[model samples]
Target: MMILGLVRWMQPVHGYDVRRELLSWGADKWANVQPGSIYHALRKLTEEGLIRAVATEQVGARPARTTYEVTPVGEDEFQTLLRGFWWGLSEPLDPFSAAFGFLPALPRSEAAAALRNRANLLRANVASMRASLESDWIRNSKPVHVGWMFELWAARAEAELSWCEQVADRVESGVSYLPAELENAEGWSAWREGGAPLDADPE
Candidate 1:
């Protein structure tokens, strides 16, 4: 969604150009957009009348290039999506992290499965981020600041990997899970102050 908005802002960008821009901005670290996904989104948006492709123009013996421009509706949708992105960032708990945070309340089998899934994802992401950091494009850069950005990305990936490892350890140990109702109750107080379940199931 955010990539689509950025493409709309930089009207007439080619697929390769969009891919390069996303890499340059470290979008891979923060979002899941890829070249194939970008192409899909572009086609869908165009078909929906959110964007229109300008006629391909030739500069030399090379093949012509298709450029896209956003319609007014696209502009409106972009703004709305951008605002929602910002709002989500303002929250303290990221959705993925929050799931791990509440693992103690989930069924033991389900929690273990979720932890394993998250670990696998983190492993893949960390490997990819490390590869990017070591790539010639990053290493051969003359700008000290840009080179440091790749280092930063690697560091962030490592942090996520560490968190995943910790979660996996707890899950493998068969740690007991507390009911959501008792999660926050003090040991003695919970014994004396019994009440209804903390969370009622929705019908």
Candidate 2:
């Protein structure tokens, strides 16, 4: 959808320019639009009759560049995909959630230290995103909506950073590491076998 939208917005754009534009928007980081994948996607879209190659030219001593424009079908598809995403409630999966499920796998001290490390990383990421929002390129070259993307990212990172810090503090303070019965291998085996369900009533 991103590639189609970009092609529609910047018709007669070359693959190189497409890649550069997406990079400028930080799409590679947030949208998973890798630099190497843009050309492949362009080819695929062309093959699917969604985007058409309008021109191919070779600058002296440079590889031939193929320029593309979105087909009417591509425009329709792009709009559909965009609308679906806009109206959807999908959230990206967080690796930390999976790791946290097995928190007791590590020593309590180590687990707390790991979460603290994550908090530090989140802090750095938030700082970088905020700094990018204030950069001249973002402020001058891109449209106002582009800045909103960075704002959204910065906001999410900030929220995660706060949560990470609070959780790290709790872990460090040994809050609910586990019930005493569930701190050993036998307990874990029982839990896994459903001999002991975490949410089961004591009665």
User: Which predicted model would earn the best TM-score?
Assistant: 2
RMSD after Cα superposition, model 2: 5.4
lDDT of 1 by residue, 93-202 (tens): 57877655555455555666776776677678767767866788677644445667656666776777677677667766754445667556555232222221346332
Candidate 2 positional error at 121, Å: 1.1
Position 61, candidate 2: lDDT: 97
- In candidate 1 the C-alpha lDDT for residue 136 amounts to 81
Global lDDT of model 1: 0.66
Q: Report RMSD (Å) for each prediction in the order shown.
A: 7.8, 5.4
Give residue 30's error in model 2 in angstroms: 1.8
TM-score of each: 0.49, 0.81
Evaluate all candidate structures by whole-model CA lDDT and list the values in order: 0.66, 0.80
